[model samples]
Target chain A: MRSLVQALGLALSDYRHEALFSACSVFVLAAVLAPLMVLLGVRNGVISAMTDRLLRDPRTLEIIPVGSGKYSPEWFRELAARPETAFVVPQTRSIAATISLTNPNRPNLGLNVTRIVATAPGDPLLERYGLPEAGFVRDEKSADPLYPAPLVIVSASVARKLAVPASPQELKDPAGYWLEGRVERVLQGRREAAGINLRVAAVLPPEALGVDAVFVPLEALAAAEDYRDGKNAPLFRALAAPRAEKRSEKAVTPENFEDYSASLYREREYASFRLYARSLDAVEPLWKWLAAREVEVYVKVEEIEAVKSLDHAFSVIFGLITGAALFGFAASTAGNALAGVRRKSRSLGLMRLLGFPGAGIVLFPVVQSLLTAFSGAMLADLLYLIVAFAIDSLFSASLPGKAAVCSLSPGQTLAVFAAVLAVSALSSVAAARQAADIEPSEVLRDV
Target chain B: MAAPAPIVLALRGLRKDRRTERAEHYSLSVPALDVRLGEKILISGPSGAGKSTFLDMAAMALKPDAADEFFFFPGARAGDGRACDIAAAWTRKDIERLAMWRKHIGYVLQTGGLLPFLSAEDNIRVPSKLLGLSAQKDKTARMAARLKISGLLKKFPAQLSVGERQRVAIARALAADPPLVLADEPLASLDPENARTVLDMFMDNIEDAGTTLIVVSHATDLMENMDFRRLILETGARDGKAFAVLKEGPG
Candidate 1:
């Protein structure tokens, strides 16, 4: 180790005398490679961030029952009990329900179209969509198993359409331009129903949901449409009770609506329900399990696969470019090393004449090559960091949510460093051989 | 009677072939030669008489044509030291042994083979450094002072005059205190005054260190007053063999 260090010191001293030339060589390499490094870093960072963002949305892992089938409440309970099932919320038949928004201060703004999505309070999509907590209080006297609040979360575009004030001061005032939400439903394709008013509980960022979608509690939509629980066979049959000749004049409230609407429907069926998997890995297994049961399933697995393929394609492209760059770097370094050997032939011969072992002297050129390559890699890394920071700073706001424009992971940095060192070391073989082959007789003959 | 000095280096029936594009030629043939411990011998020959080749063979830098029975015993303790056959050393592929052998036998080239990048002192210390010997600075300084090159130690090879460079080279040759020192025309580049001074210093230092010395030169006039043995080689072909003779005294 000490001898090796001494040889390295000698190499360094040799380089010190030719510092400018060495620096130029390093700079040439850095110039060729820095841009490539930045390109790969950006490619990896953007693609990974996009894939991660999509995967993080639990909705992407949803497997919906596509075709019509009878799914009992017991079946749903069993499915939900599985460790891989995060949540299994049944979809209501009122898929055509649209909501409109109005701000009292801007009455001139017309009703804007919005799609209504039904969700339970504990639905994972709520957290995935970054919605605030629903403030529903259960009444002790209420007999209903589920009583949903009238609150709704609107997309950012919807809030803008209603001209709702986004400032904290204005938002604190209950009367200051309260955004009015109204849900419109058609009953059995006959009469147009009056709109049910709802309060705007929160506004989601544009990235949270689709452009014009609004989220509401599932029970609220079911009650407004007088929809029965089709998954529950017993409940569906019990709801088919004969109607009395004289109907009760009292208005049906959310508190006791289940008893009043018992004789509405008989069929134990459902259009579909969202099936959430515990994780991305479980999504495929759960989909396969559900498909094996003869249930038609739809998932974002294709999209996930596409993202994976794109990532792989990018990696191959990056590998090709990096391979080419490394090849060029190796060739250039080898040429430089050969030239250096030719120039220092005398010195090498003198060392040999002094009884220095050829094996130890061979490390001279290799050490110099490694030092040059290491300096170049460090310079390129510095340049990459600067470029990444500049890009992130320049375009951070335009990026999706908090994603950076460019970044390099620790693993990627290490891989690049290793690759550069390996290339540099391998390239110096010819020069080392030349140095070792130098005979003390050559110096004698030359003198 | 005092005990006879043990033979430090001996060779018999040694031959070396020089090859070129056209044909092979015999470079050197020595019937017999021996140098005892602490002995100084001077070799004089015309050009192409294999003077340098003989020195190269002694330094183990060249391979001999014959493959058997050439001996070099390094240390003074004849009982403890073993004679290394030069033919076997030539055929062995282990470079470490060659390096070790070279470390024990110093060579001073015709023109000083000092690295241009190193100072005179550094050039002198190269062998010591190569051998990983510690505390060689004092020895190097003493050699430089003995060679009258102490003032030029800090200068690079290019900065020193021819005489100074030769003196530094001689200092470097003895830096490691090898048992055998070989010089090919050590005083050829110096003036008469510097040559005489360097010669006296070289004899004194080698005598003090008890080193066996072999000096090869073409200057016969320089060997007239010296008490060292003279080995003269006449270049000629004899009975299908090109050979040289080793005369015991000034011829």
Candidate 2:
């Protein structure tokens, strides 16, 4: 161990003594290494940005079932229970799950039909837009409560149609807007419509959906479908039960109405539901799972795959370039090290004569190569930093606040430096062999 | 200390074959030789007479073509000494084992083989450091002072004069307190005054340590008056092969 340290110190001294020659070698190494570093940084930067763009849009993780299909409650429960499933909720047929809205206080605003999308507590779309989730909540804000059922959250498109020239009080808090929600259908070739008072809870941005739409609790969509299909709605039927007998019409009050609405029409299967996967990696498995059951979904798999393939292509290209560079550099360094041993044969022979072991002599070149390559790596790191800073400064506007377009993470930088040293040591294999072949007698007889 | 061994090195029937630059076969042989502890010997020969070859053999850097017996005992006392079979190590190509014995022997090259990268003091300390001698620090300083090279200790080999480099090489050899020291033309590259000065100081230091010495040189007149065991290589050509044999030379 002491001999090894001595060898290392001797190597350092030798390298310093021949500073100009060593500098030339280090420059050549850094010249090759710096470009490869820049390439790797760019690869990481571009791939990270592409991946972040994909991840930022939650729709990329969504897996929507196509059209209408019989989705069992157990199936939905399983889907929701899946490790890949981020969120899942049962839905109804599109035709039956809709409503027409109008402000009852203003005659100017007319009723308009809007599709009702089934949403639950973990609806990604509503949450992404900073809107309230569709679920039951206490109405402490209202003096005279309208209903205790799920509140209606509308998109900006529908909210605009239902909005009247608001009074000052209405403008201050528009979530209290009362809209008369009516569901219409034709049963037995006759048109029948049922009206219900709906309160606006939150208005989602149009980015959620362009056309008029309403996000309601999954139960609300189920009840709407049942009422339109001529099935019994617990809330609507309870209200109409006393009317046919001319009994007291005020039997259903706001506090007791929740008990009536909670008893929704129960079904084993649903027509549609909102679903999402936990991550991009989860989407393929979830998509494959549904496809195995003959359920086709309208997921953003192709876009996700596009980004992933781009990442793969960049990685392959980077690997090829970096591999070629490292191999070439190692080869060149080996050749140079062999030549260096030959040039310094006399000095090396002197050390051998001084009782320095053959192994110590071998390590002499290895330690020198490490010193040279480590210096080169430092220069490469400096060059990479400058290039990355220049790239980020030049292209900052390309990704906005998303990410830097040309930079390496700290871990990657360290890996690159370590690889440089390892390869440098490996390059000295030939030199070590040459050093071992040197005899102490070379100095005596050469003269 | 135990009683000193009478014989420090023994060799018999040592021979080597070589090819000259003109493609002529040449041979050098040593019949039988033994040196006692504290003995100083001079090997004088003409140019191309195999004096360096003899030193190379003693240094264990050149493998002998054939050897009936070749052994070196570093420690003169029985308790601390063991016979080192240099011939057997050479036959087996056991370089590590041979390198281990180099600790007790020092070889001074003809051209002052000093590492150009190291300072004069570091060059002198290398042998002692290689042996892991605990007294290396003080020994190097004392060797440098005795050689009158204390002022030149901080200078690298390239920065010093030829005479100074030779002195440093001599100090490097003696600093480790080896039992035997071999020098090949230690004064060949110097003027008369520097040669006399270096040779005298080298002899004085080795004598103080009671180390056996073997000096190979082509200059016999310079050591005409010096009292030492003298051997010389005699060269002759026969049957298209030139041959040299080592034996006692006229004092």
Candidate 3:
């Protein structure tokens, strides 16, 4: 015990005795560790921010179309039957028609066409999109043009462009210059759009909308197109066929939807479908199952890197910057430490005479490196948090509600700290080799 | 009590050389030599007579360039009956034997070889520590008392005068209480009085321990007080041949 303590004390005292060597080691450690620590923080910040944003809108993980076409209704129904499957629904996307809402006194100005998407009532996508429930009654006396069986939610930009009145009485009164109508909710999509009220039912985050975009119930839209509501429009019914076993001879394809919709009077086979699973892991196997049925279906999965191009770019930039910083650190630190070790060769000679092993001399620089790196990492991580929070608060970016709450997990911190220490320790290997090369004979000679 | 067995150390026809003009060239040889236990032998010669070189060979720190046999009793022999022929051990496991041999046979260099970082006392304790001495305080105090370096214990080698540093070196040489001591012009840098003072201290401590001492010196006065055996080196016609003329000291 005494020997062990003595060895440690001697090692510690030896570090102090060689001031230049210790300083060089510590400087190198700090150099390598500071940028490495900063890189760790940057990775943590970007990953955490993306995760928070995606998680806040649960529908970010939905399998939306990358190209044309969608999954078969029968395939979707089969997937929905599985215990792991969470939710399954159909969606149709199209451009909203440019319709004129004229003002009698002023010259007409052209408005941008709105984007229209069809969805079901009480769908999981509504909450994921931050949309209020359907049937959010705006006014009782309103004879709104956009509502009846086919309800629509319009972008706030559209409402302002068409000069829609704020209330039912305002629209009805002579000053309103329009008939009373029920407003569903405001669409708060991020992209550009013109005002044309489809009756805003729920206001979404700005990222959700585009142009003069609107969301309408699938059934009502189908009914209106079929002219069922005393207007000339088409009607279509979404349906699913019985699940086909693997042994069956009827090969499923795009022609099937057309044939089935035409033949079946009561049920119209849907052209597209979306299959949901309990988690991301189940997606691959289910996709294979559909493929086995000879159904020409393509699948897509959601990862944070998918929609967040900015985050991926941030990661690459961070890595390059961190690497360059560490290189400068290793150069300056290792050079200084080696010089220090060479200067103290005589003192080291005395220690050798005092019964210290050749390996013990290396310990002096190694300990100093470890201490500096740990402290530097903690400092960098603290600075990262302060910067991330300050930016989020200042910009008021609908950046994601949880951006302020972003944080690195314990596993992440441990890995980064260990990596920095390993690099710093490696820088001392040259100094250790120099210390080991001392010849006691040289010390005894008259220098 | 039975007579204590005599430990004998000898050198015979020892030849050593250096490479001259990139060709191996033989330089000198001592034909025969012998010393019994507890006998002081002073080697005297003109400049370039290889006195220090010979001392190094005797101390086991250097190997002879050429030799028929070099032998030490109380040591194991090789198949050729030569102690020098035995393979040297340098590994950590054999370091104890190496250190023990080194501690017992001390070398006082011409220049003060005291470790610069250590004070006078720590330098004295070097061999003691190497020999695994735990009661360092007692050993240091005892050596300081004998060598009269008690007041200079805390002073570094640089701080001490030339004579004082040599005294510290002698104390270090005697630290392990070795059976033999070797000094190469130990008083070379000191004034006459300081040199004699150092010589007197060395003689008293070594006589009390009954340890054999070998001193290589230029001055005859340092050798007068003690009864010593002398080996004088005289060059011959051939480069490899040298005669060692032996003479008895005043008894």
For each candidate, give the TM-score of chain B: 0.89, 0.94, 0.80
Candidate 3, residues A113-198, lDDT tens digits: the string is 44444555445556555555543223222344232332345555555565544343443343324212121211232222122223
What's the lDDT for residue B144 in model 1?
78
Q: What are the clashing pairs of model 2? A: A91-A272
- TM-score, candidate number 2: 0.82
| Docking quality band of candidate 2, CAPRI definitions | medium
CAPRI class of candidate 1: acceptable
lDDT of 2 by residue, A181-294 (tens): 677766666666766665667777666678888787766677678667666442332222222322332344456645544433233477887888887888989989999989
Where in model 2 is the C-alpha error above 4 Å? A51-63, A80-89, A99-111, A118-141, A144-268, A275-292, A297-316, A443-447, B1-5, B77-79
| lDDT tens digits, residue span A183-218, model 1 | 433333432323334556677776665577666665
The residue-by-residue lDDT of candidate 3 on B1-39, one tens digit each, is: 976435446666776664434234536567777666677
Index of the highest-DockQ prediction? 2
Clashes of each: 2, 1, 22
Q: Local distance difference test, per candidate?
A: 0.69, 0.77, 0.54
Q: What share of the true interface contacts does candidate 2 keep?
A: 0.58
